[model samples]
Each structure stands twice: as structure tokens, then as C-alpha cells.
Target: MLEGKPICGGVRVARDEPIRYVCADCGHMTTTRTGRCPSCGAWGTLESEASSAPSKRSVAARVVSAVDVRPPRRLSTGIGELDRVLGGGLVPGGVVLIGGQPGIGKSTLLLQAAGRVAGTGASVLYISGEESEAQVALRAARLGVASDRLLLCCGTDLEGALQNLWDVSFVVLDSVQAMRAEGEAGWPGTPNQVRAVAQRVVDAARAGDVPAVLVGHITKDGRLAGPMLLEHMVDAVLTFSGEGYSSYRMLRAVKNRYGSTDELGVFEMREDGLIPVEDKSGLYWNRSDAAVSGVAMTIALEGTTPLAAEIQTLAGPTVFPYPRRTARGIELNRFQLLTAVIEKRCGLPCSGHDLYMNVAGGLSIQDPSADLAACAALASALRDVPLPGGSCWLGEVGLAGEVRPVTRLGVRLREAARLGFSRAVVSSRERNERVEGLEIVAVSHLNQALAAGLSRKEA
Candidate 1:
């Protein structure tokens, strides 16, 4: 027997051949050994693995007709919000990888979902490599998730735990990082081990025609804590995000083979469990009748859902030579850019004032359409004037102060109208369509938008 470790226990490399190295953090492959991984910039993560030769045996490739194919049926996770983010629901034999920070409700969400799936009279196997049965049981009890069909297994042997997949309708592995394969070298969470565990789970789920959800841990930098191959091997990748201080959580699909990645799911964490939030717009808007300075509203779209977002700003004389610019829920650079645009284009003296901006309800706004609203809020704060009541701002503000049209204008206007906003200020270039009971005030430049939004008389 040759004194070498074979990748597949069959082939071996020559003694003189150069060894290949794989980055444990990102699965970047290179023949040359290096101290740091070039891909992920992680130090000392590259490990040498023996390369194998291709076998001479050939198998015929099987081809299928596209016309004969049918779409896979989706299984509901018993949560409408989750199902929405999942593109309707889970497809049979599909593997979903959900990653999040600790205490961000990844496990809690999965546990509740598992209980729901089990409630439909389908056997659900909950495999926990990190938590013991007692701990999971305690959580289940607290969540009021008592389903006779929900099974629990607490161990690190991923192969052994997956053996019950044949008898279960749905399966969940509480963290893939902690699970180890029987034959894989290195401990669990090592690049090799993570790859092996994920591959085995994918194979088992496909073979058994069962849907499986895997929990993944994130690095300090917030990326998934494993080889990048782990994310590629999964059918879908979902990210759970929320601020620790806030009870609201957002679930988004970064990659989905069966559905759209644009969908978003909103949840509110409560004592009972994760409850789906229906009126997502209401969560971000105060709907206050008392018009306050520095407050502006915008109809922002999250996926296909329209949200009513409120932008608040505060501008005061700064003692420091460089006025401070602080922002929450929106990027600081964006805030600064808007302030500069306001000063240069709108003739608002924002440089001398220490600017502070925030999106109400702790909801982050990524929509460029909110640019007009943000600018309005900043100007209103600088002038200590409140925006006209029952008005909404919608349009992207250009560096030249041009009010650019945004996508899905109809959807946004309808949402604004539904929220009881009497008028919306938008780009004049946009093709205006009448939304019942909602007035549309179109402006081609930021100056017109500001005038319409801040003017005491309704436009």
C-alpha cells in the first residue's frame, strides 16, 4: 500500500508532484503555498490536500427534455412571511442554508418552522449538533411548540443523524459548523469538514426527496463562517438580519434556485414565537398628526411590498471645525452626499450645521427613491420648518440636484394613497397616472420638490 492519503481512497499522486492548497475560509484553490488566503484575506487558513487523477472509467450522460419537466411543489413552512421570502414555500429535496449572528433568531425561526411542518402530520427531524435535547425541548415548550411528529436528535455525527431522513418529511440541522462527518479529516468547522458535511446532507436530502434546512454561523465580519463552497452547495441561501435592540427581524434570500431573491420576510420576536408582520409599512411610520420639523415620509418598496418610511433629520450649529454628520438606518456617506447636494443645488446652508439623520422604526432604507425624502428632511431640519402635512416625497436626487424617476412608481403611489397620504411629490419626467384620492405633484428639479414639500400651501 502506498504511504499517502488519497482524496477518494483510490488514487494517489506521485511523490515529486507539487501539493495543492485550499483556503479553509473561502475554498480558493492554488498549487502554491502562501501564508495568507488571497481570496478572503484570512491569515493562515490554507491547508494542503492531495490531488487525485481522473479515472478512466466513463459513464454515459443522461439528458432530459425541457418540455417534459414540471415545477416542483412547494411545502409551506407554516409561516406566511417565511414562505413569501422562500418564493412561495420549500421545494421537496431542496436544501436551504440560513445564516445569522448569534441570538438573531435563526434557531428559533427554524424550530418554530419545524413545529409547524410537524403539525401538518408530517414527521420532522430536528438534529442539533450544538444544543442538547433538553435545551431544545425547553425552547420548544416555551414556544408552545408541542408536536408529536416533531423529532429531536442531539449529536455531532451528521451521517448518523441523517439516517432518519427516510422516515421524516422535513429535517433541520441546528448548525452545520458543529456537525462532523465520520471519515472527514480535521475537526468540525474546518474547511474540509464543513464541505464534507454539507455535501453529505445535500446528497441525503436529494436521495430521500426530503426538504432540509441547515443553520449556519457567521464570522465576525458577518459572512458565513465556512468555506464559500458551503454556500454554493446549497440550493438556497437566506440571511436573517435585525438589530439586537429592536424586536423586528428581516429575512432575505440572497440566492434561490427556485424563486426570486427580491422577496423579503418581516418578523417580530415576541414571548410566544416569531410572529409575521403584515403591515410592514406601519412599523416604519409613526402616522403622527403633530407635524414636526425634520420629518418627511417616503413610499419605499421592499421586494413587491411597499413600505411607508419616515426620514427625520436634525441640524444644529456645530462647535467643531468639521461639522459632524451622523446617520442611522441610512449610510453616512449618503447622508453627507445629500447634505452637500442640498447646499450646492438647493442653496441650503448645511455645512455649518452638525447634521443628524435617522429612519424611524429602526428600519434601514436602501431605496434610492428615498433620496428626495431624505433631502426634504435635511432641509426642513436646517430651516426648522415642518414638511407640509399629508404629503409624501418620492424620487432619486442626482448629484446635479435633478429629481430622477424611480422604478415601480405606480406601486409606490398606490401604497402612499393606501396609507392615507393626500399628495406625493415625484419627478416630473415620470409618466403620471392618477391614483384615486392621491394628488401627484411632479417636479423636474430638487428646488421644485423642496418648494412643493416645504411650502405651507399645498401644491
Candidate 2:
């Protein structure tokens, strides 16, 4: 009898071809018979009892639900807001990796996550492989962390840190780059040291049923410091992203092995520490109200929610042979394309227009849903008029100046409607020709849409 371990178990017997599957690691093939991979040496890449004989009983192993695994003992990082981003709460024995720019709140976030999880009665071992114990305690005191369960260990030695920890179910290594393995001679943050130390700690956590969190440093070019492959090795990759100059900090989940990757946790940095943005819309509206030129409300989508953010555009005739195009959150050529479409579709004659766009409150508008908003703002600034009150804008403006439809138009409408927006300028394909209870203006072309916005403003 030939015996071999299955990559993930549940194999089949087939006609003499040798049960085969490709390695997810190196793209190497296994005949479901090899004990260890010859090409990459990665374990669990072969199937169990996959016979090369023809015609055998076939049984399937269904994929197990996440719930099938026992619930991880959640550790509340005293920060309730950060915890929510971890999907209800942190899963026991789950390793989380957080990266950010220098001094952009990696320590603050981990300390906060520590305090919150500690506050929830879970033990938290904070291994500050970067800063000294005195420095960590000083910062913790300043951050108002008084939890007794939050244990602080100041060490840069990877093996020592993990060995000293016992019965402690949660570990946090601030800035994984700072820790070096026992025999590693590379600089602390070098690629070799970072990968070896991080993996060793992560493996220790899983073996001991302890969840570990690692804070990471960024490259000179703004990428997570260390090897690029390091990011792919973690259970989750979260980044504290935003303009470093702004108080608004966004916890964006780029890769999540456990939850929805697109999910984000918003926060505001204050002297008191990082505060969760509970009512993002309300925070968005924190800016004072004024009918300023080049300013308009645009609906932008963040995951499932459509945000009616303020869009500010500046238009002045350019005298240069080649007009300059500068934008922040919105794309540059996209702005240029929309402007060209506006001229061709609406005959707005924006040839002399110098358009600058800003998504209000320091937030980014990555979706095309803001195309019409850009057009509307440019129109308002160009025509020197204030758009009608209680009016909202949606849909993307195509290169031909047509109002292109978007996904989840109904949600956009409902969001606008809930905000007491009396009228919504939407693309034609949203609903039947008309929507009930609210006035919906459908435009299939960009010119018609521009005319709609310009008409009410001109009126």
C-alpha cells in the first residue's frame, strides 16, 4: 500500500494517470503520490491515497464554513473601532499584520487595539521590538492605557520574546522590522530578518493557540518596509492610510484571509488618541456650509454605502500652450477625459477651463460615480451659479458625454432619498422610467444631464 499525506485531504482514485494537482506555491505538479514537493519543498501539496487505478469509488470533501472552526477567543484592543474592522472582533490565534508610514500611528493603533482587547478581559502581550520598555510605558500612559491585562515586553530578540510568553493568548510585536532572529546578522529591518522573525512569531502563536499582531514599517517609497513577499504571508494586511498631514486616518484592509477585503475602519487622530469615525457622513458634513463657487455635493461609494461628499472644482482659463492638469484623490487623465467629454457632449466650451477637483473633508473618491459631480462642479464654477437646493448627482460621464450607469443604483438613490434630497440626477437605466415618492431625472446623454444641472442653477 502506497501512503502519502493529502495537501488538504479528501483525494480520489483514477485511471492510472496518477491523481495530479498543481502546487499553489510554485505551480509545480504533484501526482498525488509524492510525500514532499520536489520542486518547492512546500508541505500539504499532494493528495492522500490517490490511486493511479481506473474506476474507484469517488467521494467528495465539502469545504468547511468559517463557523465550522471554533470561534476564536476574541481579544478586544481597548479600541472598539479597530476591533470592528477585525470582523465583530479579533479571532483567537489569528495573526494580523499592520503596516504604515513612519510615525503614522502603528504604535498608537496597536496600543489602542491592545488596550481595548485588554479592557475586554483578554490578556495582551505587547512586545515592543522597536521602542524600549520605558518608551512604550510612557506612550501608553499618555494614551491613557491603564489596563492590567495589557503586558508590555520590550525586546528585539524574536525567540526570546516568544519563549518568555506563556499562557498569554495574544502577542503584539510593534514594527516587525525591529525584531531580529537569534542568529540573523542582517540589519534589524532587512528583508531576511523581517521575514524570518515575523514567520517564527506567527508560527509560535498558532502552535500555542495565541493570536499575534505585528506592526510593520514602510519603505522609502511608501511600501511596507521589507520584502514584497512578506505582505502575502500574513492572515490579513491592514494599513493606516491617508494624508500624513491630515487628522483623518483610515484603516484600510488590503488583504484579509478571514473577512471582506474591501472593508475599512475610519478614525480621526486627536491628542486624546485615535477616535473611530462612527457617523462618517456626519464627519463628512463637519465642514461649514457655504454656496462657494467650484463646490458641489457628489455621491461616492465606500463599499456598500454611497457618501454624498463635497466636490470642489476650480475653473480658470489657461493661457499656456499645454494646460496643466493637477488633481489629488480623483485620477488626472480621468478628469481630462471627463472635461473633453463635457465639451463634446454639452458644448460647454471648457477649452479654456483650468479644472481642479477636491473631494471634501480629505477623503478620496476612487469611483467613477463622481464623474457627473465633477461636471456639475465645473459647470457651477463656469456659469457662476449655485445648484438648486436639495438636489443630488450620481452616474459616470462617459468619454462621449453620455451618463453611464453604475452598480447598485438603487442604493445610491435610497441614500440620496434618505438624506431628504428632493431630486436626484441619475442615469437612465436605474429603475423603470420613474421612481416613486421622489423626483428622479433620468438622462441618457451627458449634454442632457449637464443641461439639467445647469437649468436649475440658471433658474
Top candidate when judged by TM-score against the true structure: 1
Best by lDDT: 1
382-425, model 1: which lDDT tens digit per residue? 88888899999999999999999999999999988888999999
lDDT of candidate model 2 versus the reference: 0.74
Candidate 1 wrongly placed segments (more than 4 Å): 1-18, 319-321, 457-459
Q: What overall lDDT goes with each candidate model?
A: 0.90, 0.74
lDDT at 123 for candidate 2? 75
lDDT agreement of model 1 with the native: 0.90
Q: Lowest summed-lDDT stretch of 10 residues in model 2? A: 1-10
Candidate 2 stretches with Cα past 4 Å from truth are 1-80, 282-289, 414-420, 432-438
Q: Work out how many backbone clashes candidate 2 has.
A: 13
